[model samples]
Target: MEKISVFLDDYRKAPDGYVLAETMDECISLLYSFDIEHLSLDHDLLHKTRNGFMLVQLMIKEKLFAKRITIHSANSVGGKAMYNLLKQAQRDLILSDSTIVSLRPLPLHFFPANVMKHYLEVI
Candidate 1:
């Protein structure tokens, strides 16, 4: 099976080989439909009802996640919240072994320098 990668953001463009999901609904739909290997998220979608944080919450509730998750948002509070929630969910999944997990690291070349630096500095 072909492993997919999803990028969720309203303004930023997805890197090559990634599917762009500009809204919560689109992200959810893609998650349900694909065998996603990696997911890059951004908060503050310019909409009150839908955003990256909501997507993380929904993923936790539904027990769905990509093998690797990256929070690329510049919003400190919302980014941290999403990261924490996803980390918790990932830990739970690992403890329970309820889903298949990938141990492989993501290819870092796809990430921009600023995004990587920001994420590294935050965590």
Candidate 2:
């Protein structure tokens, strides 16, 4: 089986099976080094660097392909802007169409249905 490679920015926020990176460089390097099915980006990434953080820009610029990109951002402005920018980049061939998804907080009893749905649909 091909393992899913995930790049998670925040250690505490990261889900299982993710490789967390503290720096944008490390994150981008991991992104560049492999093909990933999913990526989790935190709003804190923007705090580390402007333009919605370096990793995002790197993914946008390089047009790094992924099955999905989930942004777990608390900052409304940054989150919305990042979502739009990612969409535009994809439209402009700066990113892939199947890449970039906005992650939403689910209820405790939701049973991760949406995540499972995405995974099943992808498979």
Candidate 3:
């Protein structure tokens, strides 16, 4: 499987080395197609009805997950909701026990380069 990084956001331009998915459907397509090494999600999208939160719901319902997942929405409420749900899924054995889930409130403009490196650490 080809390991790839996915960035799901409608507005933010993904930092180098990430496959940018502007919409939930696009993100889901990538989720189904590749071995996602790292998946960073945003809660608020241009299409609120089909935002990152909804993506999280679909991911859980469909058992679609990555090796590592991060909720990087600036919206604290939505980000935490997504993060907590994923954490709960892991706890409940719904998602892979080894899959690391994190809440990182990423800025809309500045994306830390360390984040890409952070996910590459030996688990």
Clashes of each: 0, 0, 0
Residue-by-residue lDDT tens digits, candidate 2, 1-123? 353656444434445566776556666767778777776665565346633345667777777656777765556666666677777887887776656466543222343656645433442
lDDT, model 1: 0.69
Task: Report every candidate's CA lDDT.
Answer: 0.69, 0.60, 0.88
Q: Candidate 3 on 1-119: residue-level lDDT in tens?
A: 78899989888888678899999999999999999988999999989799998999999999999989988899999999999999889898999988988897887777677865654
Which stretch of 10 consecutive residues in model 1 shows the poorest summed lDDT?
99-108
Residue 16 in model 2: lDDT:
55
Model 3 clash pairs are: none
Of 2 and 3, the candidate ahead on TM-score is: 3
Q: Candidate 1 vs. truth: CA RMSD? A: 6.5
TM-score for each predicted model, relative to the true structure: 0.74, 0.70, 0.90
Residues 1-123 of candidate 1: C-alpha lDDT, one tens digit per residue: 567888788877776668898888999988888887777788878686688788878888886777667787767788888777766765865323333322212233365565444323211
Misplaced by over 4 Å in model 1 are: 94-123
- List runs of model 2 lying over 4 Å from the truth: 1-3, 50-52, 103-123
